[model samples]
Target chain A: MLKINDLHVKLEEEDKQILKGLTLEVPAGEVHAIMGPNGSGKSTLSYVLSGRDGYEVTGGDATLDGASLLEMEPEDRAAAGLFLAFQYPVEIPGVGNMTFLRTAVNAQRKARGEAELSSGDFLKIVRAKAAELQISPEMLKRPVNVGFSGGEKKRNEILQMAMLEPRMCILDETDSGLDVDAMRLVSDGVNALRSPDRSFLVITHYQRLLNHIQPDVVHIMSNGRIIKSGGPELALQVEENGYGDLLAEAG
Target chain B: MSEIAVKTKAQQTPQVTGAPKAVTALDDRLAAMSLPQGGFSAPARAEALSRLRVMGLPGPRDEYWRYTDPRLFNVPGPQPLPFDAKAPESPLFAQRDTLTLVFVDGAFDASSSDELALEGIEITTLAHADAAGDHWAAGLYGALEAAGQQPVKRPFAALNSAAAADGVLIRVTGTPSKPVHVLHRRAADAADAVWHHVIRLEEGAELTFLESGMVGARSNAVIEVDLAQGAKLHHITAKRAIDPKVGLSHLFARVAEGAVLKSFSLAVNGTHMRHEAVIDMAGDDAVAHVAAAVLGDGATGRFHHDDTVFITHGAERGESRQVFKKVLKNGATGVFQGKILVKQGAQKTDGYQISQALLLDEASQFLAKPELEIYADDVKCSHGSTTGAIDEHALFYLRSRGVPMDRAIVFLVLSFLADALEEVEDEGLRAEINERLEEWLTSHA
Candidate 1:
């Protein structure tokens, strides 16, 4: 489960408030989507929740499994079962994708006080998972996100999500640069990981992605707060009418 | 009467303005050094000393010294540093199938080294060869170094040739069964050492030469390599001395017809260091490559490293490449000066050079100069130089994946050094180098 209670944040370098008293809660085994226009503080919430720099949390708190996530570093957060699939996955020129993934898997394991996986064991699981995601061995051997297509990057991110298998996942505009076919492939990768004791806080600007990875609950966010909440029908309504009516009604 | 008059004039003009201040320093240096008493190397040593006396130490003013100041190396009787214990040699090579030659403070340790025996190879110490009188090494002694003096000045190389403390001579006539490992150890502090090594690969011969471990505070070395028709030489050097003193070195090579030469250097944690490489392709279809990967941190004290490389294409269809990369942090400094020249009639020549630095902090800095001159109209030559900070986005991306900040930085640093590491042809050697680089980065960063 993920919890955010009246979270307030601002830019550390400037006198600007990004998240103004935002509150939301996603219980276990639920997929929740947040629909918002640009500058409505959707990305800020994801960054703040993941403990990125340049954002100072002024008030309130965010928790995972009732444990405070604000005080932990980003790596520690991931070890505590939190994952963030970035909108733009980074391109590291020299670090191989397989090396990065193996390091991450072992790092999280070590942080969680578990035994490290042997090279043989790791190669087996990685190859199987990669096959399901349509990632070839060559793609896995190359540098992370270097020379990869948009869909390949998204699929790589999902592969990371699958490998880490964190309890709480945050997909920040994962559908932004993906096409319809690519979206389907990526959605299938995400849907396979959906299960009880797992939660997803999907942040998207439209309802198209929700059709592939159906959401159990939909929330409408304006400014920095969630002003509306409903079932999947809410996504359908937003897709048909846009955010203009909702923003005016919320105000 | 005329000789007496000349001696009187020389003594009287000691303070003349025409004689540069460097000459005075050179006199002090000569007084402190003596040539090998007698033997095959005596004439060459005397000749080198005469050349040193003529050129003298680098001038007091360093305006012509592109990026490094030779004043520290020119200091006479430099204060001794507290001698640190000799660091452990690379375990990767110790157990491997290689001929290990150990040197303590630049002096060959006979008892600890393996027997000088190998198929198709003749190995002997410079001292041993000198005592033998008119040996095979007589012809090669200081030959390439004297030839490398054109288009540049290396007064210290002349000094090394003249008063070398200790060195090894290797002559390869056929394929060697294993690599030759030059292992250096430091036993005293502020150890000022000069050494010269001459390696000759005969027609169709091949060799892999490895130099590793730390040296003394002030060490100067010169290696002369001669590759004949269709010969090949792979030379690799790795150093990690951090005494805040100095390390000066040069690798002068003459690559002949259809020969191939590849030299790679890895330098970490040193103060006031400069490594110069001069390679000449004298025969057609020869291939040459020189590369270095350096990491310097000023956190402990002053840290600086400079690499000066020059490659010349003098024959048809010759190819040459130079790659240098450095990682600097905590006020560390790095410099690279590289040049390539293609002679006339050297058509279809290929030359490439690239130098890059990744400054890990605002206090760190990198300076570079890259040049290419081609007299052949049909040659292909390109060069580039760049300096930049580490990618912040990439750092965060690695960290978010559950890798700690320290490990993530190491990964990125290795990534920055990847291009330079690629120059190592042997896969096992490259892997060992990567492991060594990772260990250094972990401890220093």
Candidate 2:
């Protein structure tokens, strides 16, 4: 469902290359995790795929279901079934969380030439989904991520992913600021959305998140390139030892 | 003593022989226009006229009028424009429960207005009240406007007081069950209209006053409010005008002990528009809040909007807040001048003022002057002003969620004005005003 080839990215303001000759693909019905040490361009890969600004894509071709994702605007990419769960969800001071979600959902529907969801129907589905994530109605009414705790922001991101239901989901360090309980809850939410046609690119530095939501494939990323590919056991091996051995092997 | 020395010094310094040409020209224009006649209090009219003569119309050089030129308003005759008699898509404050008063070309339209009386409240047109003589409204006609003419001069308000042809007088004896709405509809595009409204909330009484619609091509309006001890009043106004219209409104309010006054104004469009407010806290523990949300977009790149506010705490334990927000696009200009003053005996006073603007493009501009004067040592006061473009990160966040770029911009612009909109006390009114804001955004964005 997602494909990348020889991707090279650098900071637009400075001549600093973050992603160099990186290539990875997540097939339909499969979940993949990318584990790397600090400054391995793990986050940069996700941002580039999601069409964030301030990144100069000097070389690369990223496609979603045979559509050139690199040439599309951010919203068009989103409409093409791409979703990014931000590592640090932005704190929008005055846009209500519910309003943001509804606008997003309806905007995508309209772009795809589908009828807009009625407010009544929207409310019913949102309430049910919010209950599953332990998000109170009050939190839904408050501004998006403003004054929200770290766990709540993460959960909100998960809720957005569930609402958008994108075909290709990129989880950028979703486990960084979460506690054990929160990580478990978030993992459960993601695991419930698993389907035959959906794919996830889970990026993290630790293997603890994979324990809850098992990955079909694990890739060791270093120096902006995936060095090794293995089964789920690879995550456990890294957690038990560390990235030091993997770095030496990749070198 | 020193007083005699100062008098001698003033006498020695040769005073200017005559007023500036702009002042004299404005005075000549005022002299040419006939003052409103009939049952108006003679002394009040005389005093207001005298004050207008002395102050004249403010010029670009005036300290308070530095950002907003008063030239457009000083014209001798109304500049004619093609009038669109068709009412707005949705007339504001049109509901069954509210008492609706209509003004056509600055004159009361009794045929279109609702009943003149309501339970617990008394209402009468200024023309009728002035003709009746010795009415309760006589005491308040221009009293608040006269009292507000201190520390700063509002020549336009004085001119409005002296020249307004007709308006309404409202007196609330007790809590009113419904609000009073004044709706202005212009049929003559080139008509110049001036109106003065006086409202008195009796002790412990409560009322809501709502004003909407554009008055005329060249319009000036003054609203005077006197809140007795423990009384409460809520005032909301919305002004939406197309190009080639010049509008000015002044609100003067005095809050007594334990009284509360909350006023909000929303300006959506205009060639040139200015709204000024002056509030005085006369008794201890009084509270006052004044807020405005303005949006200006000139298709021809010639729109201007100004919101000037002055608040004074004259008694102990008083509180005042001023919030002004503006969104300007397409080479439009927005201005805000706000001041907070705490008197010597007004200890424990709390004052807060904030003015912000969102410039949609490089050509759009925002000018703000915020001032605070405190004679009391034990008071809490703060003022802030900011001008910037929309948050790029927030814009991206919304766009990444599949919202179109234009829609995302509207969301952020509306969010910028939400803080000022929150000052509206009524949820229903706030929602209506927000809908109007959304409509404005849809057209401009």
- In order, what lDDT does every prediction score? 0.87, 0.86
Candidate 1: pairs in clash: B83-B189
Question: In model 2, how large is the Cα lDDT of residue A112?
Answer: 84
DockQ, model 1, C-alpha based? 0.64
Separate DockQ for every predicted complex: 0.64, 0.66
Docking level for model 2:
medium
lDDT of 1 by residue, B247-284 (tens): 89989999999999999999888889999998888999
Error at A97, model 2, angstroms: 2.7
Tens digit of per-residue lDDT, candidate 1, span A5-105? 99999999999998889999999999999988899899989888887888999999999999999999999999999999999999887678998999999
Q: Which 10-residue span in candidate 2 chain B carries the lowest summed lDDT?
A: B1-10
If you score just chain A, what TM-score does every candidate get? Answer: 0.99, 0.98
- Candidate 2 on B287-374: residue-level lDDT in tens? 9999999888866647889888999999999989998999988888888888899999899999998888888988888887788999
Q: Which residue pairs collide, candidate 2? A: B39-B130
